[model samples]
Target: TLVKTKGKLSFQEPKTKGSIRTIKVPDLAIQTLKAHKLKQKEIKLAASSAYKDHDLVVANWTGSMIDPADINADFKIACKFANVPQIRFHDLRHTHATLLLQLGENPKVVSERLGHADVSITLNTYSHVLPTMQEDLAQNFNVAMQNIKKKSL
Candidate 1:
């Protein structure tokens, strides 16, 4: 995590032990990141001695850490260009969690991916998604019973 201390920005350890986690990235996202890394390598070569490699996934043209404010500004512009509602970049985390829950992903897995200290926190925060999941569960159960009956016959 990035933190500002005395007007200087620096990386810091996560607030909780649970925050240290390995998240499973989708194949498409992995591909995109690989492409970005290749592009970054090209940029690094172009920059030559001027490039400062902090090994960041996202950085400025000269390989310096991009300010969070700049990222938010760019995000806002992109949202405007895409004709989407403006939302804080941090809100994307919540959206990710909510979408996963709605898709019937196991809450424990979701909580781990989210780096939540406890699964209960994930459940409480996304309780609104549970109703839809409950309906899906009922439909799935009925299908399973029908399949079992068909097999027995």
Candidate 2:
């Protein structure tokens, strides 16, 4: 579902304007996905005629789309097992954006990575993460001032 449509909410493909994006994944994620695909293939063979294949990277035992409730329940169980604070699945997006901003990535790049409508939206959502950038700017200004003083001497 498009979260911010001025007209009407529609159940369409996610390839809307400015929403479609490609992101690079690390080797660890690639390895995990490959392992998951192999496991899914095994499951498909075991289920045989009962299986309903959706070609999903994340799906039910029979390869159908998983229900939201099931996801929430499983997430909670996993969090408890890992001894981590419970967070909603949606929170992962926020975490990703925050980490990128904190790591000094350009806001526009982060915005595009997140598939936001524009950089302004990304700035509005993550401006708090720019305090580190401000500190870096201050240090750079001090270095420039010191260089000018040495040149004058």
Query: Who wins the TM-score comparison?
Result: 1
In candidate 2, what are the lDDT values of residues 1-153, reduced to their tens digit?
322356443346676676666788779989999999999999999999888986778777877766555677898889899999898767778989999887778888999988988899999988888887799879989999999999999
lDDT string, candidate 1, 1-153, tens digits: 887778777899989998887888999999999999999999999999999999999799988877788888999999999999988788899999999988888999999999888899999999999998999999999999999999999
Query: Ten residues in a row with the worst lDDT in model 1?
Result: 1-10
TM-score versus the correct structure, for each prediction: 0.87, 0.78
What lDDT score is found at residue 21 in candidate 2? 65
Clashing pairs in 1: none
Query: What residue pairs are clashing in model 2?
Result: none
